[model samples]
Target: MFVSRLLAMCFLCVLAAGGTVAWKQRNVTIDDKHGDEVTGIAPKYLPSHAWSSGPRDGLNAKPNASLAYNGTWHDSTHWVNNDQIIVNFGFTGVSVYVYCIIANTPPGPFFDAFANYHILLDGVFVGEYRHDVEMIPDYFYNVPVYVNTTMQNEFHNLSLVANSTERAVLLLFDYATYTVVEEDPVVASTSTDTAAPTSCSLLPTTDQPTGNSQTQIEVIVQVGAALGILAFFVLVGAVIFHLNKKSRTPVLPGTTLRHISRVPRHLATFYRKIVRSLTSHPGESGGVVGDKSSVAQVRSQNKD
Candidate 1:
């Protein structure tokens, strides 16, 4: 029983240690974003762009193709289409800007610049920006936009369109990207279906109570064994004492002789009485004295 208990305790200790280790190792982290536009982007980095068209040729100028450039001056406005751009990076937030620019001196007929614009994502129209009255050099209108789409599998379309009869120019595209990371789910170290030893349940649920119980049982068993041994020794000692007492009890030499002597005294008295009673009888004879002498001799020999 003691050996079995020792093994069970060791097993339980090992299980507890293993569980602790497993729990410590059970954690998750979001690695990175998962789309296309994040080509040169670091784990959490965002991309930016800015561009412009010349004043004289703005009417025929094309929108800037570079991802980093926004737009500038022009006779006719051009649109920058980010609709095909998808940020593969794992991010939850997106910020976009639409800038309208007008210069002070124009080559000939530069109409007062004014325009309306709209933002789109995944073919769904989200928001719109309208600027009707505008004029002057480096005069620029900025529209700040924000969107929250926590998770995405592919590139999301982002775009801005200009609706203007007068010539309009875009000077900047300020983009700020943000990511919202979700907390990893928690995991248990051990399965609920795992079987534990029965002894684990037998262990004291409380330290003090268990300790007291163990102490009490140990004390009781120790006391009982001690008492049992003591009793056994006491019985053995008593037997030995009796044997010693019996052996040591005084024994007189010639005890039979002493008893015989007392018997002779009693017999002599009896013989004397018999003789006196016989002497008082007139019919007593010498043969009776001879018969009495023979009986006395036989009694004395039997007593010896």
Candidate 2:
């Protein structure tokens, strides 16, 4: 029973180790697609009256109305400096890798003042995107070009601050797109059959191990430890079985067991001495007190 309990404890330890490793090894990512046009996440950030003067420029302005527009929350604007356009992603931040897309106004940059804009994420200044209209020709104003910026960390919300470098240089703002990036460990089973599942779930899997270095090392270590524990348990169980069998076997009589079989050791010795004395002298048993002397004499006369 002791050996069985020890083996069971060892097995539990192995299981706990496996669970710990699995918990530490887990890693996953999730990305969300929330565009202003689709889920209306933008309305919560930008308000209605805080847009630059257009034919009818307001927050949530549609395309084709005016290429010369702006995006984000807050109504604060200024002609001299400090024109902030903020887009809030709320408290629950999304994954990393932010991609923003903006289109220039249809009227072209050569006609209007260019925009020198600074990008910020969660209040930290990132980089700048310059739409210097004077350098660009009128033909290319309608065409959309790519301007990209990357951050070392992900954030909940982002902001684009625009201040006029020149007189009346109002930057036309377009809708921004939000997306998340994620990656997780991909496990492949050795059974490359069409029916096999691609995931490493609890379903039946092949005996062949994974090809990844980390996974292979973990598997080897776990198997080795488990086998070692099992081997130890088997050895202990065999020894215990032999010891128990030897302990239960009966002893032969006439040895030390005979003297000490039932009674106490001292009492057994006294009883043995008494039996030896009584059986050795047979005459003492009949006339020890001489009370039958008369009977003995009568028997002798009859005989004569």
- Give me the candidate number with maximum TM-score: 2
Candidate 1 structure lDDT: 0.43
Per residue, candidate 1 scores C-alpha lDDT tens digits across 21-121 of 22121111121222224343422211222222232243433323332223332223333442221221222333222233323333235433344555556
Q: Count the backbone clashes (under 3 Å) in each candidate.
A: 15, 1
In candidate 2, list every pair of residues with a backbone clash: 69-173
Alpha-carbon error at 287 in model 1, in Å? 93
Model 1: C-alpha RMSD to truth? 18.9
TM-scores of the candidates in the order shown: 0.29, 0.34
Candidate 1 residue 292 C-alpha distance from true site, Å:
81
**Stretches > 4 Å off in candidate 1:** 1-37, 40-108, 136-138, 141-154, 165-304
Model 2: residues with Cα > 4 Å off, grouped in runs: 1-40, 43-48, 52-78, 81-111, 135-155, 178-304
